[model samples]
Target: MSRKTLIPIGPYHPLQEEPELFKLYCDGEIVTDIKWETGYNHRGIEKLSESKSYDQVFFLVERICGICSTSHPFAFANAVEEIVAVEITDRAKYIRSIIGELERIHSHLLWVGLAGHFLGYNTVFMWAWKYREPVLDLFEMITGNRNSYAMFKVGGVRRDIENSKIPAIRKEIAVIRKKIDLLTGAVMDDPVIHARTKGVGILTRQDIIDYGAVGPTARASGVDIDVRRDDPYAAYPLVNWKVITAQAGDVFAKAEVRLLEMYESASIIEQCIDALEKMKEGDITLKINEIPEGLGTGRAEAPRGEVFHFVVSDGSNSPARHKIRAPSYTNIATFKKSCIGQTIADATLSLAAVDPCYCCTERMAAAYDNSSGKKILNANELIALSLKRTSELRKSGTGHE
Candidate 1:
């Protein structure tokens, strides 16, 4: 008789930096079943948002995720703008689009680098990250911060792009586009990447709809739903762009979708620059006379997927209730289904296929101390411990073995 083996891959694993556990039920090298557990980094940002005023929440929302900070505030502000009926200027809309696409560029580059690092392709990782530096530099040139731009206000953007900066932005766009094309071609042509990614973990179209997946995850599965197209906000409706889709429903498909989308993002930025060049200068923001009691919902396509923000007001300065529906929240649910019946080595790539963003959409479950017979640590504590251990192992050269 054969024995059943249970291999725990996380709560601390090299493949995932986040504090989530994957118990792989396997026979030899082949995985038979998989179970996931996540409660390691829940900060309750949504609950905390209810306590903050509209103006204050903008800053709070930025902390939801470092990578998608711009999109969080954009979504939150869009909700508030809808309720207040704020009329943003055309220039502000173009600025918003430019900032958003810049963020997408940095984010996709970051993911590509991380994915490469996960697969032991250190050279690819280094090359991808080298390309990402310029995007971050361009962001700092405009927003004054590399990560949390804090450029979006409830009514409109905080500042307008200076006339002199237009030429620099165009030059940066042209340079970055050429570089991205070169790197994306390299990624597609790499045989090792193709072997590890293609047909590894697949999500069918029906599975995407049933699981409420969004962003590239759903698009990879042939579910053509992008908030930019389904519910256009800011200048998306005014722009000329098409949603990128893949029918393969596998990890390679997701990677292709993002790579192609980056090209589209560059084109979008070019369009925004052109639009900004022609717009007449005026006020970037509208005066908020007062707040009326109402509820508003805003949805935007973040780099990972659709980000949703709901705000309820009681005619006061602060919000009555605030809820955030991060794209990762929906996308993470399909992991178990996609990961089952695959090799343990495929686990990391499969997880990366969804573009998991732990810091943005995570909620921690309480931890128990068996020795003390009590719950001793919170989710954040567990996450910190997990990250600490992972870092220590990487430094000591004795972790994944």
Candidate 2:
């Protein structure tokens, strides 16, 4: 008897931190097809950016993803800076890179803890999250907020990493490096973990390329694309750090890439810290009177992958148009490639392997009149609605007029 069943894990599942629906069509234990839904978390952030000043847009974009908060601001700053044609101080460069790398370490640790919990390995979860606290503490010490550091701005950073603080930061980094070593060893060497993740949900290099996956998802499949190295930005070009990759493209391979990348991130942070030690602080931001009419594209490699921001300036305080493409936008699409043919039990882990950020991946696709149950807004209509709302806010003296 060929019996098929549909199993759904989402829209409000416990496995995911946010609401995303993943539908699995399975025959017995093997998943035959998979489909996922978004739009449940859309907030129209790009449209909102047009109403805020260039300086304020950094804060707006930073909330795109809590884990990749700084990542968005870093890219946004790069975009606006491109429009302004301004160069930030070298000291600011090092501080920016240090903050970026620290966020990478903390974000990877968060993913590792969540991955452990998903696999029913509570001890690994405990160890991973416990060590992650120190990294968050480092963020608090430097930027005051553990998640959304708000350290970025156009042309430069908001805060300078003082030379006096480098020693303490290095001490914390050393402790974190030791903890990472232990966690990496345990995960890499555990026979149970190997059995659960090694061959499960394997994605070939072609799959990664076809899906246009980024970050660890693509790197795990042997794709050597990194914005930090390929499209050099901020202090990444000044620092020496190699991209970490794995050949398997499986769940274990993804884990391997993230773990090894943490080491690379730490190394990059140390080098940046050393550079910061030789420079004097206080040259953090560059004053820009205005952003001239131009279009600029910026790319930053977040903990998951490349975060791209495009800004169009119309010689105004606010952006004429703002567009964002987070790494998860493409990475989430890979669930179709990795989850199909996977066992139902392995499908969720495969989905989680990419560390998809639902909030970062959503956009308002369509709108309807709920009362009439009829489509009322298409893409153009949605844009008009956005513009209209911005105009209303401006008229009310709430937006940058």
Candidate 3:
């Protein structure tokens, strides 16, 4: 009998952008079991949200994920607006949706580039990132920053997409559309890419449901669910676009869904830009003085999946209780299903298939001592306790692996 060898992937790995630890127990080249650790990047964002006022929280949450920067603010705005119960103007809706969709394109392109780099296809990486610049340029043209765009607020956006900038934005979008077509064709038709990813890292529709995965991860598995369509927020309902899905549920399918979704995002942006041209500018935000005591739940379809925010207002400027859930929290859990039967060479690809964002996924897991207001457990202690629990579950025949 071949003994299983332990291979550790992270806490810090070249492939992963953030700190996370994945323990791969393998028999020669085949992975037999897996365990993972998080909490390395916890920022206490929810608790921090309690300290900031309603207006300032947008800026705070915008830093949650650099790629999904607008996503956090969009969801936060939706949650707070629900409590305020104010109807923003049509123009505001158009601008808000434009920012959201543009962010989607930017984020998808970024993932494509990173995925290529992971596969050692540097040409695709270069091409995808080159096209992604135009999307960020559009963001900088509207907002001042390329990454943390502080545009969204309680009822509307902070800045307006002026009519004068429409022509330039349209021209850039046209160029980006052509580049996307080329990149999509190149990636989709490549034989090497097909051989590498077609059947690797597959997550079934049932697996997605079991893991509660969202975004492209779930959509690629033929689980047709998009919060933009299901919940109907911003200008997603106003514009004409369809949710992208693929049946295969493999790494290739996830790539296909994202590439195709870029077209939808571009289309949505163009429609929004046309709407912006017709409507008068400067009517961006509603005057929301205070939020009455209430609970509000808001969700946005981020590039990864759903970005959910729950806000409890105690009739104050700051939230009484704020909770955020990023899509990777659920999507990352699916790695156990997708990678267990695969070879070690394919394990990293399986992990990246969901476009996992460790920073966005990190949440505090109760390490604090309530009486002393200090941490009771260290990292080593946490890991030992987690391993102990897993062993207990497995010995009891209640665990999957």
Each candidate structure's count of clashing pairs: 4, 1, 1
Residue lDDT tens for model 1, 304-338: 99999898988988888888889998898888778
Ten contiguous residues minimizing lDDT sum, candidate 3:
378-387
Best-to-worst order by TM-score is 2, 3, 1
Candidates 1 and 2, the one with greater TM-score: 2
lDDT by residue (78-188, candidate 3, tens digit) is 898888887778888898899888999999999999889888899999999999999889889999889888988888888988899999999999999999999999999
Provide the overall lDDT of each model, using Cα atoms, as 2-decimal numbers.
0.85, 0.90, 0.90
TM-score, per-candidate, Cα-based: 0.89, 0.95, 0.91
> Model 2 clash pairs?
11-20
Candidate 1 Cα errors over 4 Å, as ranges: 364-401
Q: In candidate 3, how many clashes are counted?
A: 1
Worst 10 residues of 2 by lDDT: 392-401
Which order, best to worst by lDDT?
3, 2, 1
Model 1: ten consecutive residues of lowest lDDT: 43-52
- What is the RMSD of candidate 2? 2.2
The C-alpha stretches of model 3 lying farther than 4 A from their native spots are 366-375, 378-401
Writing each residue's lDDT as its tens digit, candidate 2 over 133-163 gives 9999999999998888989888788887778
lDDT of 2: 0.90
